[model samples]
Target: MTRKRVLCISYQFPPFAGTGVFRVLNFVEHLPDRGWDPVVLSVLPGHYERGTALDDGLCARVNGSARVHRTKCFQGIDAMLSLRGTFRGNATPASAGQGETAGTAPAGKGFWQGVKDAVTLAYRIPDKQVGWLPYALAEGVRICRHEKPELIYASGGPWTSFLIGLALKAHFHLPLVIDFRDPWMNNPYDELNVGFRRRVNRFLERWCLRRADAVIANTEPLRTLLADTAGSGNKCHTITNGYNETEYVGLKARASGTVPLVVTHVGNLYGKRTPDSFLQALTRLIDTGRLGVHEVAVRFIGHVDEARINNLIGSHPVSAMVTCVGVVPKNQALKMLFQSDIALLIQPDTRLQIPAKLFEYIRSQKPILAVCGEGATQELIEAHGLGVVADADDPEGMEGAILDVFRQARSAEGHVKKDYMAFEAGALTTQLAGVFDGVFQSSPQMKNG
Candidate 1:
């Protein structure tokens, strides 16, 4: 059988460690098995923003037949600042992990810093990664001319990837598929607060949606929102994030009641996803002597803002019960989750977004104590009997949920109930392949070409 070719443009790919990289990586790894050869176009590693960890293990997972082309990005403000500092003999090499660097801060202390910060924020109209577009587009066009792939697939929040796909479609007349790992204009954590900028983003989103041959949303709620906005429900489809079952193979589940009830949260907290309510609830339970501090322990194992977490914990008397493990390797993190008595799934109030971490949590077979809003995460937990769910904003509910999970742990009945076979990456990859097949067969351009 002749294999179809898919040109995938994604700014987030391995060896970058984060939830963002897994979707495309899995697609690349499994597409060939489904009769599609994936050609990936990604930004060069050095061009990535500082503090993004390089996961070599993920890089090794790419299929040998899949061709990955990494191109250089024009130096952004941080890179420029670092260059100038180097020329002046005063700069250290930038860290290789995710977060803002010192160069991204204000040019000076106090007022000057505020002014510089404002300018920088404004300059990042769509996103800070906009600087990568020119390089990505150049590489994309070059690849299209050489390989002439049947379709172009772009995944984002460098949302620049979609722009590249759009440009490639316009230039080559190839069908384009844009995947939304998160909503563009409706993003709850969008830092672009200016009314005009927000309007610009909305316009851009609509423009892209109209031109793309198909849209892939990682969640059903997101697909509905995108379809509603684009006024083309037929063009949108939902293909959620899933865990690679191979990762969990041979990993033993933690024996119950062997340790303190370890409730583990395995990602960063920001915006509405903070642990303020959870901390407050823990504090109240401790203060009221409803739950012993020594009976339960909370572990955070990723890149969370320490100051914010510290402030929340310090306000409560449950400080001794919490451990912030910073970040660890993906394998180690998975092991931590497997050993955990309960997994923490914190969701923002937005109904359109679900953290990609939930599938991994489910795969661990560890019960989830979800402090979330009314959204897919909550629905999934309730539907699957995956454990307890509570509103992130409700201290009483959160406290009750936590206490319940702790009680279940004490009784050795805290394991996750449902088998999430549908969420296995291999199966989900087949669904993605079906989407690609449908899009390819229906596209007049592909048929003609």
Candidate 2:
């Protein structure tokens, strides 16, 4: 089989830990096994989120799996601010929902944000990172010439990643498979203004989506959104974020074969899904002795809203039982999930959000307590019979779900692991590779094919 060369332009690559990295990570990590060569074009380590560690092992795998081109650049402002307090990775989708999350972009976010908003009348900036465009374009073109990949896969956060792919598609006529890890203009979370700029962003978003041979979205809802933005009858694919059982390697148990029902929430805790109710409910479980002594511990094992955490713990019941482990390494995270009898998947509402952590929760082989969005998440969890779900916004509802998982755990008919390998990392990558394969075959110019 001939190896297909792929140029992957990812705005925030590894060393930039967050949900956004998952897009290109699978493609780059699995390309070699699938007979594709990936040339990754990305910014320097610590470019946006400083000290956000990359998985060296994963990088080694990517290094062996494909070629990487690092176009190192940084903002002096970000660097200077580093001295005062670490600028969290919460800016772009890389860490969206993690920090002060979507905190009102200050009146003076920067020149481009203001100009784009004014010009388009968009309430928010138009895919900010407008500053990164020129550099990514120049570097992407250079990589395109050198590697001359059969197809370019640009997954975004800086949004410029897709722009780079579009540039290559226009200049080299290379087949481009643009991945929308997050939506371009009409993403559910996007705060859109009422007028001209919103229309302008809609135009650019449509142009990018329509031009792509195929597009990949993280959720079915997002796929629907992309399809609507791309117009009727355009093809959009949903290849979700997942856990790799094979990559899961080995996991450590958080509790030593004991009965205290442990509820684990991993990954970014954005504003969309508040954990206050979840924590409060679990505290009630302990208070009423509904949860056996030491039987209920709620571990929030990732970056979260620290200030809110303090306030919630102060007012809510289970202050002693709730522990916030701020952003540990992935291995540690996996271990937390492994030992967990219940995986807590929280979202703000049954509204327009589906946290990527839901898939990982299912794949963790633990019972899931799904909080929020009955959209796609409820569909999959129910189909798989994975776990119980609660509404985070409803304390009683969330508490009820927690106790249900606990009851199931102690019952003789303890929940057995379902076939979650379907959501494994490599399988999902293969799903994406199929997208690339289709585009490659559609392009007539590849001489060898």
The residue-by-residue lDDT of candidate 1 on 1-449, one tens digit each, is: 67899999988998887689998888899889999999999978887888877877778898595899998876466755665456545533343223555567433336545655665565565667778888888888889989989999999887778888898999888888999998888777776645776777777788899999899998887898899887899989989888888888777777877766788999887766788888888888888999887878889998787888787777565888888998887788999888888898888677777788899988887888888778777777788788888886677878898888777666656653567888988888898888888888888875676
Checking candidate 2 for backbone clashes, the offending pairs are: 15-54, 97-270, 120-197, 260-295, 261-295, 272-348, 349-373, 350-373
lDDT per residue as tens, model 2, 318-401: 666678888887777887788887788876544434566777777666777777657767777777787787766667787788
The TM-scores of all predictions, comma-separated, are 0.87, 0.81
Q: Which ten contiguous residues of candidate 1 have the minimum total lDDT? A: 90-99
Error in Å for residue 238 of model 2: 1.6
Mark the regions of model 2 whose C-alpha exceeds 4 Å error after superposition.
49-58, 72-125, 188-197, 232-234, 252-257, 283-293, 305-310, 313-317, 350-353, 412-414, 446-449
List residue ranges in candidate 1 displaced over 4 A: 79-123, 305-317, 410-413, 446-449
Task: Return the top candidate by TM-score.
Answer: 1
lDDT of each: 0.81, 0.70
